[model samples]
Target: MPESRKAAAAMSKTGQTEPSAPATETSAAMGGSQASPKKVSQTGAAVEKIRSRIIDLTIPPGSRIDEPLLLKEFQLGRTPAREAINQLAAEGFVKILPNRGGTFVRKLDLAEIGEIVVAHQLVENNLAQLCRLDDETLADDLERIQTVYRVEVDNRRYLNITELNEQFHMRMNQSIGNSFFHDFAQSTHRHVRRLLVHLYTLESALPEQQDEQFELNVRQHDRIIEAVRDKDREALTEVLPEHAGATQDRLVRLLQSNTVAPFPVKLRPLVLPGN
Candidate 1:
């Protein structure tokens, strides 16, 4: 099977679109019982913390989120705990099931990941062709983003690392000088960051491995920004696909080894487990 096909199968098997576990194995793995709470006093603070934890992968993908556990962990009450989940659901960070069943974190698999990779290619390539920004501004901004990512990664401030990375890419998109393209890039920022976030984090596999990958990424950013600076549309046609392909490669391997899981079908799934 092709790498994409293999990735698709893995994602479909693990995708958690709804709060319910679609796969028998995953559902079984999440097995147990926890008591529900009655009410709580404050929800706003509880929700913010819950949102942060889920986004930071503190809760982790596929880890069953029991409200009572959250209640106790955060020292909050039932109402607050429930509200936290509700907000997460709205952001597609966590999916809430109907009738008080279960909540599954939205896990994007390799295939859904592949699609986003392709989107990156489309946007970045065209952006490169149309880049009309001043070299000084682009260089300065890219450097700032790099500085932040390096500092955050070195300090183990993983969340900040992703935000910095996103800032760099968004700056790249805006370099295109097209309002429409800029809007598209802005809309996709959340999804792109969600995928890239894991890829950047997984490099913690080894000290050498992580540091080496970080250096290479910084170099890559330098190259892409340099391409924009030089108006190298030809170079970008070659570069952007390789960039996205690297993301695909990273996503496939990590999703397989770490069990990162696939996205659950929001509407009708184009693919399913074992197809």
Candidate 2:
């Protein structure tokens, strides 16, 4: 009921977060902490805060999480904070260390990244094959989304463009009316977005290069829209792979170079061939 708690709850729903509150008595329990039923909403907010940081690479990959510091930062009680960390651990972004105190963000593994990309491409390819985006109402919906994307593109709002791109993909999957595939696609996209954020953070990937890629991505979306309009499966397949392949290669190249952002823990890139 407190103002801070209310704000936290709102942030949880939007997956946006603020700086963690300074540590208090609430910071005591971390690993084995237990939150009460009443604190569930606050716990969720804490989780969102953590997740947002992870996605933005603010909580860099392979970084050791400081429970007390996080507790202080989020101004959350022990139970809620620990629960949030545990949830992240369950989501595979954080690893719970029984021997070591607190949790750690998982290191980026090139092999795992490749698997995620390939799986995403297959799922999307299948969705494109089955989706009837040519339906008048559905086409209108996609057109509207694409309109917003174009606005972002013209304004050079690169980050907003990324979000719009994800929205476009999510909408495409949702239009299929398959709840299972929709949920799977959502998870895959989340990982893909995080990878993109990580890639953007690297020194080797200059801002101009990222801008060029964004332009290319927008053009590809234009092609995909045309493909959907014409109901051309082959065109859809081609454009979709091209879109994903560029990111895949950029990710691999970032892994191959020695330009990783600093973190408390050292994460060696899983050296896979074809880099």
Candidate 3:
């Protein structure tokens, strides 16, 4: 079977449903006149399948996405495939180069990494202040994710660790009860996740270290949980940014050492002020 087909099947079995675009908008974007509601729904499903692959790096960064291949893989018509690609482009996940017909996943931006760190700090600090979090509210959820996270760390399942780590933070953010804040935080988490996976994949090729970083990550989770338990807003303001900043630093060091390069793509790098 083709890779996309295999992926679709696997996702079907797993019942994974990370959110994606709305079918109505997606169909309209790709010439909706001929699009029935059923076709539009299929277009949405196709978009999610491709989006999930990008999120997990299954398609890997720097890979070109052939529309014909996607159409064939998902058994989607031209309108649906084109629509999915267009949606991905708008979302910053893929780029369509001028004079180049192929669509490629957007490369990692070195400068944006720093900016994302700063943005995360600002947003999370505000969230920490606005929300009233306490142990009683977050304890059960945090404990459940932490249990799985610890096991993943010990087993050296870095990808699983990344997912659970995000879940742990997601649970913390859920305390805010504001959908907009929660969604923003989730998007930031996805960017951070790509960086983590990049480092872990690079590390896998080298001599095995003591896994100190993973251990520290777990400890950081503990600290965040404790801060929530104590209703220590000051502690949260300090630790959450620190956690993201530390990851930023690590990624920079890795890039500097040439241990790993950003995913190769055609788009110009996003350079923020003072970057």
Candidate 4:
């Protein structure tokens, strides 16, 4: 089966809903009644912290997850710590090995990254094509998200920028009202979040370049809004690839730069579109 179909089937069995935030499993874990509210809150906090570290590359890819260190660092009980790891594993940020091989942070190699980019483009383009332009509120909702995304960009909050970007595209996908596509898009966004983090991190040292790239993103988003409002499928098709391609271009350039440190996982040559 295709990976997206497999993910859809898994989500069906798991009953995962569209996530407003990057760490949807945290919310799911918090909503469970097996733990006290305080413990649940702690678990949620731990999950967010750990997940953020992983995304930001602080935890590094493929490193063994230290449960005891997490408990001590987060001041979490054993149960809460375990719960947090379980949630992260489910969310694809962590890999839980069988037979006590120990859990590790998931690694992204060049091949996996290529597949993710392809899947991302497929799902996002499909969503844009199928979206109901006459939904009346679709443009308005996207405008609201873009507003917040602009703020995060201006504030240089890379993490918030990534989260809002996901929310922006997810809102578009949601407007199509297809649960299967929504779930697949949500999964792709989840995987893309970490890559965006790396992209933003690479640009962190170059304020001028970063600002220029972010401004371009804002304008692309505006064009997307305009396309939606005007019911212009041609404009949507033209702009969506450009917007996605910008990130791909930046990542390829950054990876090829000598100043950047090596990734924990071995990165083979990246073959993006037009490369």
The candidate scoring highest on TM-score is 4
Report, for every candidate in turn, its global Cα lDDT versus the true structure.
Answer: 0.58, 0.65, 0.65, 0.74
| Per-residue lDDT of candidate 1, residues 15-130 (tens digit) | 31111111222324455223343333255457646655655677777666768777788876676677778866765667776665788776666455666676666666566556
lDDT of 4 by residue, 36-106 (tens): 77887898879878887887689888888867878778888888888899989887888898775889998
Collision pairs in model 3: none
**Top candidate by lDDT:** 4
For every candidate in turn, the CA RMSD to the true structure comes to 14.7, 10.1, 8.1, 9.7
Better of 3 and 4 by lDDT: 4
Per-residue lDDT of model 3, residues 181-202, tens digit only = 7667777776666667767776
TM-score of 3: 0.71
Candidate 1 vs candidate 3: the TM-score winner is: 3
Q: Is candidate 2 or candidate 3 better by TM-score?
A: 3
Off by over 4 Å in 4: 1-42, 98-100, 261-275
What is the alpha-carbon lDDT for the whole of candidate 3?
Answer: 0.65
TM-score of 2: 0.69
